[model samples]
Target: MNITINRNSETPIYLQIAGTIKNMIEKNELVKGYKLPGERQLASELGVHRNTVVKAYGELVSEGLLTASRQAPKGYFVQSAVNSWNFNNRFFPLEKMIRYHYNEREKRFQEIFNDSVDKGYISFGGIVMDKKVNPAGDMGSIVKHMLQFDEDGEIMSFYHDDSERLKKNICHILAAENMYVNAKNVQIVAETNQALYYLMTLYLSEGDSVIVEEPIVPDNASIFRNGGLNMVTVPMEADGMDMDKLEMQIKKHKPKFIYTMPNFHNPTGAVMSLSKRERLLEIAQRYGVPIIEEDSQRDFRYTQERLPSLYSLDQYKSVVYVDSFTLTFPYGVKVGYVVGPYDLVDMLGRLITMTETFVSNMGAYMISEYIERGFFAEHTKRLAAYYSQKLDLLCSQLDQIEQKGITYQKPQGGILLWCTLDENINERKLFLAAKEKGVLMMPGFLFYPYGYQGRGHIRLCFSNVSDQEIVDGVRLLGEAIDQVKTKENCDE
Candidate 1:
């Protein structure tokens, strides 16, 4: 038996030996029932301690590659190669796996989001609005009222186009935001993201470039990536996506379409100003590029006047608008809709037909009845008030930590707050350390794509936690930051 060891290598001796032996087994040089040299004899030949060889043999034995037997000349021999085969035996390159190839950040993101909290751990991971503010009673009342008109499953008919009544109600909702569109141009989707995915599949072929604003919610870029499209990011300023830098990138890449969330933008909660919206439309129209506007959170605005949607401003029919009430009603209702030019809406209708997937007509009927009868407007008012109070309380709590070198913008309206820490504190280290103290907030790294790191920044969602939990969570978060800072000072 020939075995080589590199003393200068950082890999442990046992690992190196096990790896070499495993490779030999995979290449068939060491078939089943092949005998390994005696630990003492192998150590003598390799000029290493017998214990090192013992540990190596011990690892393989534990892995079921070898079994104790007197059948061999010594005592043990290879047993079953099939039993030793692992998940990596597939030999497929990781880059070819769509679920993980484009980004592993999403897996890490899921880990943080899905962590089961201890009895009292404060979790701020999900973006769902606080249930206390959700219009559960109103929805219950609506559902109870809708059941009266069921007429033996008549509303559940098979030969259906997107509900004409629901589509018109959505049109009226958009009209309130100054975006006037006919019901024929609206395609109801189970969720807003479904609209985005369908649009990406319709417009972007593999390797096509799509312009996106940076520091967005992960789903925004992830859907485009899954469609085999490349993303060109335009940095977001306080007002919105930087138009000057955007024009520069436009000149360079000339992407197929631009995607943005103008009102109460994700993670950052930065609302675009009216002027920025106008300029955004002008630039897209000038370049002959269409825009996909995710207008999901605009209804939750707390401070300023609502901005006109890009779809409303486009006379050239250059924008596709997506909206959902998933926040106001929470995840229970998946009602959302897409509005665009007649042709694009027709294409989406065809795609839905091909997939044989349609939005829940029952969910549509309930939401439509709620909105038409004016329950939704009143429900939103109540939600705005509830979330506004929480927002104020959270800002007050954050103010208490201003002296600790943690500062954040008090979002005008929306559930998330973007915070920046002192240059000395590492946000990544603070995230893990904070979890130990029973408080959770997302590290900003998950929001950015590969090759971009959101250092010294953390995003906290006020949408999900309670008033008391917010205080304790932020206080614990502050303590975590201080612990990091204090340790750094002592090390210095």
Candidate 2:
């Protein structure tokens, strides 16, 4: 009932009224079944014509935000109480405070994951590093060494002014992968998540189009949507994104840039083949489109023949490389970097400074120390060996139930297994049954831009779970699939 009307605004009075009320209903300020003031009463209160209030009420009613009673004392009632507000359009003209928001699907998934964890579910849901392989002791030793040797307190205090040492170390790290770059081209961020988010917000405005893989990492999809970028998603094939579809989308949408995880892609774990890498780079450069290569999983290769990163193969300087130590090291080591053109990196640094002030100097120092002592190379080798075994076990166990309509390709590297259920299997029911069986995984639809055409897929992350847990978790998943099949049979 407390609606404010800005008389001077260009938006119509009726629209402003309707938008405000809709916001209230979505925010749950006006809970379900709350009665709205009658048109005449509200019109009088706001000093508007009764028809103006009627127009406002009509809009909300049409949108299903409110319901109109046909009774004599006709009043509008709130239809639903939404805890999470989902705005289909870019921004609310009335509410200038909410410039951007989180993806509602990602928000719900976080809730479900948290709830499952609280119930002690065996988690195949997160791409987290396994504790068995965590280099906490080694990292701790470095931390102690730095503390003991520090004369200026730079490591212990917030006295660092730049990311020079970390950038130089990252250059060396990339050099080992044959992707050479100078410190001037590197801009550090808290993590790859931040790197993507900052890049999208910095370079693109709201409603600008960008092309991405269909079943992208939910977190990255969330970032794109929340930034108001019109995501043109191309489906993933066994090798990589469907190149023909990618080209079509590129020409149609004319995206600001292309974002790819050409290494071991998240969720799918499909590495871009050598041919695809060259082709993608060629297509990107031909279109004068800059590609953001997110190589977070580049270091986790197991059985796959390593292909040169798109950044390394690019002769056109059309690729911006983004990577993180979070996946390679402990999650607490939130160090990530962007290697791009000098001006872009400089601008990214300025944006980081203006917004977050600075990246974690301690994390930077820790990574630099690890690289300097030659520990990083050894650690990655150890991870590859350890995780390869886990991946093998997961694939073998999955092979046991392959006849049951659960299908997947064995990824040569990376943390996750992208699975396709039989077309008839109810994905929602399967997810619930899995949770009921004390196992959790990500439904594939959550990874899609608008949950389009992903009902038959799910992603199981193997890097975090123990070998025994992986076995048990797969058993539970198989059982869940059986339950769904049984239920479907019963329904028939």
Best candidate, lDDT = 2
Clash pairs, model 1 backbone: none
Model 1 Cα RMSD, Å?
14.9
Give lDDT tens digits, candidate 2, residues 193-263: 88888778667878777899877776787777777778878878889998877876676567778899887
TM-score of each predicted structure versus truth: 0.75, 0.76
lDDT of each: 0.74, 0.77
Clashing pairs in 2: none
Overall local distance difference test of candidate 2: 0.77
RMSD of each: 14.9, 13.3
Residue 260 local lDDT, model 1: 91
